[model samples]
Target: MSRVYLSLGSNINPKHNIREGIATLNLRFGQMQLSPIIESEPVGFIGDPFINLITTLETELPISELSSQLRLIEYDFGREDNAPKFSGRTLDIDIVLVDQLEGEHFGLTLPRKDLFEHGYMLYPLSLMEPELIPPGQEKTVQELWQQFPFPEQKLWLTEL
Candidate 1:
């Protein structure tokens, strides 16, 4: 088994989508420690703010299998297949990291490059694993959160 962190989001029926996403994830992968939800203005799309959350869990499935499962959850939750890039959606689930291990498979890499660059991922990540230090980075999640420059977007716990 490996400790994997996932990022989930929705701009459409966000609250409901988040709740359903959590339930689906738990049912498929067992227990999880969820971080708080964040309501942030759409990054590239102009629309309602998005509700984003992060969760860390242990899974026996391989990284590729886990990614596939998450993709299925998103599709099952009503995500569109041919939506405009970065446009608001019914759901988005990303495999943020898989422990400290980093390797390439099927032309994709674990610990997504944006994971260390975007506050969207780091903010919620800090809530669940404050002390986790990204590989090749000197800062912890909490430390990175402190240094990240994303504007003051609302972040809080939601009824789950």
Candidate 2:
């Protein structure tokens, strides 16, 4: 089985969406390792604040199939494919890292760029998989997280 790390977030009915989303992922992917959920102000859009976290699961599906599966879950919770990139979401799930594979696969950059850009994503990732080394990175997630400029952003630990 391939180990996969995913970032999950929601702003629209965030608490309900996040809990249900976690249940669904657990059912579909078997056991999962979860980080502490975080509540944060939305990025690049004016809307309700979002709750975000990282989860690690083991799956036999390839990258494309895993992406497709996650999309299906998002769709079930009202995600619209045509929605603006920065719009509020019922649920948003993205692959952060899958095994050690690098480069573009199914149009996704390995270790999605948002993983590096967002404190909400990176902090939880570091909590869940502190030792992870994404492709092209010489430092572990924990190490990179230490250097991240998070003071410019606001994120709070939240309970689901």
Best by TM-score: 2
Instruction: Tell me the lDDT of model 1 at 123.
Output: 86
Error of 2 at 11 (Å): 0.5
Candidate 2's error at 87, in angstroms? Answer: 1.0
For each candidate in turn, the TM-score is: 0.90, 0.95
What is candidate 1's lDDT per residue for 10-88, written digit by digit as tens? 8899888888888888898887998877777776667987888888889888777888888888889877778787798
Please give the RMSD to the true structure for each candidate, in Å: 1.9, 1.1
What TM-score would candidate 1 get against the native?
0.90
How many clashes (backbone N, Cα, C below 3 Å) per candidate? 0, 0
Residue-wise C-alpha lDDT for candidate 2, range 1-160, written one tens digit per residue? 8889899999999999999999999999887899988999999888999999999999999898999999999999999989999999999999998888788988889878888889999989888778988888999989999999767778888898
Those runs of model 1 whose alpha carbons end farther than 4 Å from true positions after fitting are: 152-160
Error of 1 at 18 (Å): 0.3
